[model samples]
Target: MELKDRLLTIAKEIPPGSYPVDVGTDHGYLPAYLVKQGIVSRALASDIGEGPLLAAKQHIEALSLSDRIELCLCDGLTGIDLSDKTHIVIAGMGGETISEILLRRHPLTQTLLLQPMTKVETLRRFLLKHGYRIEKEIPAYEEKKAYTVMLARYDGIVREGDDFFWTFGALPQSKKKEKYLYFQSLLSRLEKKQKGLQKAQTQERTELDRLAILIAKAKEYLQEELYDHHSGNL
Candidate 1:
């Protein structure tokens, strides 16, 4: 089965011989792909909805991967047995939902592959404040929409992140071109919000201040990136 670029980016972070559990496995494509490609010996795919789980079951059965891929209908990691070597994948969900799942029951797994559909900064802040280290982030684009898949691990040391870190995470260290595009997208959104707030007489002061800071930081970073590209320093 062919996976989309976003899921493929998440798949690349899974090392060989690692056991993976995909939460919210809509169609179980990721697990099936991993097992089919022999990246993993076996995997567990789960979804909270019965319809999605049934679809996943059919897909797994059609692929003749029932023996290698187990299906479950449960909320995030509620009944799954997580080992230290297990890799948890939670994608295609809002950042707040993902955070709530992680906060509900902390997993013993060492590695996590997370891709949030919206509110990326909220997820970043939750992870950093709760002792997870975002080891790396990969940028993925599909159908003109940008997404990031993050590889994180628990270190048990809580730390706070600045506005830029919360906004972009480790994305600034990504490839120059992808980084530039992602930053530009973010800047555009911030500027649009700032303008709307400026025109509103009832705008919240705190939100306006936050937007200004983010916009300034984004411009500074973009300028640096462009200069480096021109100077052959990238």
Candidate 2:
């Protein structure tokens, strides 16, 4: 089966030297691709549901890669003694759900390759709060949807006030033209809901304001910081 453009980008972001644990691996294509590309030594394909695990098993079996890829039926790595050499991948899931999985693991993980389908800001905030650094962010446009593939390491806790930037990358560098337009589109959608938001409780308005801050700060970064060009490395 052909990998979708977004998932292919995610597969590409895995470091070249380490085996990865594909959490919630629906079809096992990522592990299949990684091993085939020599990007990883082996793979542990896992999913919480039995249905997906069965499919994963079929994939490995068909590839005749049973020796190289191990399939596990796990609910977010629960009760699994994951090896220290394993990098966990949790993509194609919601940010909030991904956060819970990492929280369940606590402070032990080799690396995290995460791509949240929705609530991306929530996912980034969770990673930063739990002490993960954005190692690399690869951007891709697939099926006319732009997505970000993030490589994260358990570095240290970072409480950034920049509003969920860890999902995209640090604000300073993420202000690339394409991302800027995406942010603007998000803000435009929110503004169109101004009437509904304005009628909401004070707390909801506050939440909307916080979300808007991302676009506001981004504009500042593009108009001002990009031109500075000297205070820090580009």
Candidate 3:
């Protein structure tokens, strides 16, 4: 089975000649792809539940990749063991969940590929508060959903001071129409909710304010050259 563009990007980040572990691998697709492409010599496919574990096993068997890929039934790195040669991928989860997993499994590995389904800011903040350095972030929209997958490494001290770092990673500010229009559309939607809604409440107000700030900052980044897309470089 072919992987999505976002998943492929995460897979490609595993370096040219290295082994990687796919955490929360739903169907063992990524490890299989990497092994077949000769990008990685081996992979450990892990999932939290048995349903996905069965699916992964079936896929691996179909592809005859049992030797190249190992399947494990684990919960958020509960029993994960990573050597110095392991690159980890954790997706299909919230940012907080990803952060928790890493917090428990820190000393085992430093290289991490993270994709959070929601609460990404919380994840980014948690990483900074801890000792993780977000090296790279790639944004992609697939299946009508926008996903930001990040590559992070271990550090001893926390990095700080960027307020909008979670929303826009080092992707060059593009006033080139699509990005500006998307931000505008998002702003419009948020405004519509805040304007004449019959069920206006405190939670909605709080969320509306947050979205508004994100929209304004996005505009600022687009209007200026202050876009910070990566963690390592500027």
Candidate 4:
């Protein structure tokens, strides 16, 4: 099975011996790919709706992976078992929804790979405040759309981050060129929002101030990157 860049990034994070449970598995592509690649012996693919679950079932059956991949119809790990060394994967969902799923039923799985389609800062804030430490974040872009796959683990250490941390979670420190692109994307979004607010002639002071700060930070980061490259320090 072929996986998209976003799903492939998430798949790369799964270790060889893992028993993964893909939450909200749209078409069961990730699980089937992992099992077919010999990365994992078996995987459980679950979706909240019957339509998506049936679609996944047909895909698995066509791939001759029905025995290796199990399909379940459940709402965000509500009835899933995590007693074994299960790795949780929640992708293609909103950040608020992912946060709600984790908040409702905190998994015992050692690792969680989460990919939020929107409101990524909200998800990062919730994860840190609720004792889940973001071990790593891998950025992926497909069709000019930016996405990140966050590898997190429950460490029981609650930490509150500032606006910058919430906006760019350990991305600035990354050596990958995608880090700069991600920052640029955020800056573009914020600039557009500021323009919209200004055009309406009704601006929220707090929001405008936050945007100004983030914009300045992003510019400074890009400036530093350019300087380092020119100085042959990168």
| lDDT agreement with native, every candidate | 0.86, 0.73, 0.73, 0.85
- Model 2 scores a TM of 0.78
Candidate 1 residue lDDT tens string, 65-173: 9999988899998887775348889999999999998988773446989999998989999898888998888888777777888888989889888888888778746
Better of 1 and 2 by TM-score: 1
Supply candidate 4's per-residue lDDT for 226.
Answer: 35
lDDT of 2 by residue, 83-176 (tens): 6555788889998999899898887568777877788778777877888877666655566566666777887767564544542454325535
RMSD of 4: 2.1
Supply candidate 3's per-residue lDDT for 44: 89
- Record all residue pairs in model 4 with backbone atoms less than 3 Å apart, i.e. clashing: none
Cα RMSD to native, each candidate? 2.1, 4.6, 5.5, 2.1
Could you give candidate 3's per-residue lDDT for residues 1-234 as a string of tens digits?
A: 577867886876788777788889998889999988878878888998899999999988998889988888998777766764568888878888888888886654458888888787788888777777777676655675566777888876778837567555434243233344434444465457656442554556666676677667766765554334563222
How should the candidates be ordered by TM-score, best one leading? Answer: 4, 1, 3, 2
* Per-residue lDDT value at 43 in model 4: 95
| Deviation (Å) of 85 in candidate 2 | 2.6
- Error of model 1, residue 185, in angstroms: 1.8
Worst 10 residues of 2 by lDDT: 166-175
Better of 2 and 3 by TM-score: 3
Candidate 1, run of 10 with poorest lDDT: 225-234
User: Model 4 segments beyond 4 Å from truth?
Assistant: 172-175, 226-228, 231-234
